[model samples]
Target: MSSVWAKKVNSSKSGFILSTRASLSRASIVGGALGFPRIRLPTKYLGMPLYKGPKKSFLWDDLTSRIAARMEGGEAKVLSPGGRITILKSILTSMPLYLLHVIVPPKSVMCRIERLFNKFLWSAKGQRRIHWECWEDLCYPVEEGVLGMRRLQDLVNAARMEGGGGS
Candidate 1:
């Protein structure tokens, strides 16, 4: 967040801040004089939403939407089951890891994310395949159950545990 302000506010090339000492008109003048746009809060920085107040479920929708977009693409349909599993375990899961540590996404957002992953994992050639087993069964170790990918709920619990553990 500071990095954005550093470039826009501190540098002579641009400017920022809707400050107390200075009104919006003054800030606009400064930015206009420097030829830069004014930045507002609740903006995205490094792919995660930056905002004040509660971490609402809707805020995490971008993470789900991105996954949904990936799943909706033509390329995902060509991958084999094993290939899909590998992508799920690697790319899909990793995308939300950083944000999970920062905010505990509400149940709806997590469900949407899991639903997208499950759909991607089971679908074949753009056709929806019937799921033979519960999603949880596929996520555990082979000996205990099955092995595929970790659930978003597990990741959330982990993030909560990690955040609470620092004290």
Candidate 2:
């Protein structure tokens, strides 16, 4: 009999209601009853965008920024080429795969991301370097003696084909 009942809904905290159609203002429902603030659209949930509008390139800008932020410290001088390839294949490239699975990014956006990966693979911090090998060649199967780095464009095409859309 020593337990206390903490049954307050904490009217100070804000809440969000994600609805596909803004026909009804449910914000008022909770605002009046619970004193919670109403959230606006174009917000994110668990780091993924939550808008239902047309799929535009700008919609995914946050994704590329996140990728770059993760690989910000150019490891060219710290890790060997093999290490970089392993990290890129296992981590950096895989970061967007989850989002890619749900949303097919525009080819132009994919190209920009691919270029960022290429530059990181070949260049050092604050300096440019030649891509001794093009990305397509690098993406060759590992059995063919090259590192198997899948290109971003190839991923978009694969997703499209998988979803019944032609190349």
Candidate 3:
């Protein structure tokens, strides 16, 4: 029965020879991408082919290495609070939220605008925005008619604390 089946397949006018080669090529192309290099089965073995040897997994290894390298480059750098404050001010002034809306209207942009407005309250220019109210007043909780901005004075005091208070 096996001999008859093989004879029928090989003797077909449909050109099984070309089709088999095409199938092998397609399988190899897909298997190579999946890190399984193609291996030629011995003609004597009708079934149950063995895994010949190590199929170089360089494609998979190289892709993973590139992703790891990129993550390392984007690591955040530490900066002084004062430096952060200056950078925030520059971003706000250079590209106000309203102006940014024309270029890239996004929810994050609106959030940033809100944050900058809050920062203005902590800035030296904050005093000029309103009279008879210190920067702390504007930062007070909504119940106090302020937006609950964190107190810069407290942060400064904490920074100057002896032995980094409350370790």
Clash counts per candidate, in order, are 0, 0, 0
In candidate 2 the C-alpha lDDT for residue 165 amounts to 27
- What ranking of all candidate models by lDDT puts the best one first? 1, 2, 3
TM-score of each: 0.69, 0.69, 0.20
lDDT of 3 by residue, 1-112 (tens): 3554443332222211123355866776665555444445321122222222342233123323333333223220233335434443453333332322222223333333
For candidate 2, lDDT tens digit of each residue in 100-163?
7666777777877888888778866546789999777788788999888997766766776654
Worst 10-residue lDDT window for candidate 1 reads 6-15
Lowest lDDT 10-residue stretch of candidate 2: 158-167
Clashing pairs in 2: none
Candidate 2 all-Cα RMSD: 4.5
Runs of candidate 2 with Cα error greater than 4 angstroms are 1-27, 30-36, 74-76, 153-167
125: Cα error in model 2, Å: 5.0
Query: Which candidate should be chosen as best, given lDDT against the real structure?
Result: 1
Please, what are the lDDT tens digits per residue for candidate 1 over residues 1-167? 35554433545443354544567788778877877766665667667776666767766777888878877788787999998988888998898999887766677787778777888888899999987776666777767857657877778778777442211
